[model samples]
Target: MITTLRFTMLFAAALCAAGCGSDDEPAGSGTPGTGATTSSQASSGTGSGSSSGSGGSGSGGTGTGGDVTTTVVVNEISAKGSDWIELGNPGSAAADLGGFGLCDSDATGLCNTGDALRFPEGTELGPGEYLLVLGDQAVEVGPGPHTTCLAEGPSSCFYATWKVSASRGETVFLISPNDHVLNQLEYPMEAAADGQTWGRLPDLTGQGGVTAPTPGAANAAP
Candidate 1:
């Protein structure tokens, strides 16, 4: 009886050992190596997605650009001829000179207005190009802010006169149609009678030669 009992106990111990080994093999096969492979693939996919997203974000916003500028060079105030307002383009790119204006303190009709000048739409002034807007009868050149000059120039086209009765000198302010103060000149120490030009010549006296512009700045020398 004792021998039989010992034999049964040894068989039971062997069965338990076999069962443990069987359970361990599946745990090894289903887990460690497979789990690592899956994790690595998931990480690689996430990395690729992040990289593509960043690349797309970097390619989204970009434009073409150019510049336009105007300068007033007061050539000569006329005696019998029409008063002249000289316009010049000093920029690299061509600019539309439409919707521009010129004004003086004393204007009749549209002669004195801030919205006086009207160029053809898309009228581009190339670098160093110039145009002369005859300050005719519609434009009464005097002092102060005015808005009718350009609108009336066509009407005053018959007689655009800027006759200044100078007392020593006079001041003429050229306000742009854009409301930009383009040029201002104070003619001093001259005759106080009509006929003399209100501005300094660009070549000789430097008094009325527009604003002596800073290089690279608006109104700068070409």
Candidate 2:
């Protein structure tokens, strides 16, 4: 009977030790928790979203291009008999000179008449091209009248019915189709010579000086 009691006690002690060991064990040792796995996946998704956002910002830095501007200028002038004014296109592309205006300025360098000679339709100056407008008296000389004036049969010259003042040395103005002034030149009475022509020295951007007549060509060296 005593032996039987001792065995029963021993069995009870073994059961207690097993229960204590199971209660003390760490949780989630055999399998992961559902909540913990979901949190880990959310963090990974957030990291991926941030990377994608950074990529989008990098691509947004590239933009569209710039603006382009163009201009034309008065290149040369001849106040002598059969006077002519030269228009130069020094830009990269052809310029439409249609509806452009030319006016003879009074002694005060102001256009009093509001009377401007407008270019005919379809008038275009090519890149680096020169256009010559000749006065009424000028048609008598220098390549002759526009009809048969060309040495090569066709000419690059146009007739201007108005004559430039040779003795007074008037101011010349170049006007756009919108009546905006593009360029102007004031010449003194002494600058007008009967045979010599006053023009820009080095083509488009030079000081005016007395040189030989160059009606349909570049200005001669001063």
Provide the lowest-lDDT 10-residue window in model 2: 39-48
| Steric collisions counted per model | 19, 1
lDDT (Cα, tens digit) per residue for candidate 1, span 1-222: 999999999999998887645444655435554432211001112111121111111111111111112433322332222344444443444544444444333323122343344443444445555444454444454322233433423222212234432342333333333344333433343421333333333421234433332211233222
Once fitted onto the true fold, the runs of candidate 2 whose alpha carbons sit more than 4 angstroms away are 1-70, 137-154
Q: Write candidate 2's Cα lDDT for 48-108 as tens digits.
A: 1121111111111122211111245555667765567776665666766566666666445
Clashing pairs in 2: 82-138
How much does each candidate deviate from the true structure in C-alpha RMSD? 23.8, 25.7
Kindly report which residue stretches of model 1 are placed more than 4 angstroms away from their true locations once superposed.
Answer: 1-76, 79-81, 106-115, 138-178, 186-206, 209-222
| Model 2 TM-score (2 dp) | 0.57
**Candidate closest to the true structure, highest lDDT:** 2
Number of the top candidate by TM-score? 2
Question: Relative to the true structure, how large is the alpha-carbon lDDT of every model?
Answer: 0.35, 0.55
What lDDT does model 2 reach?
0.55
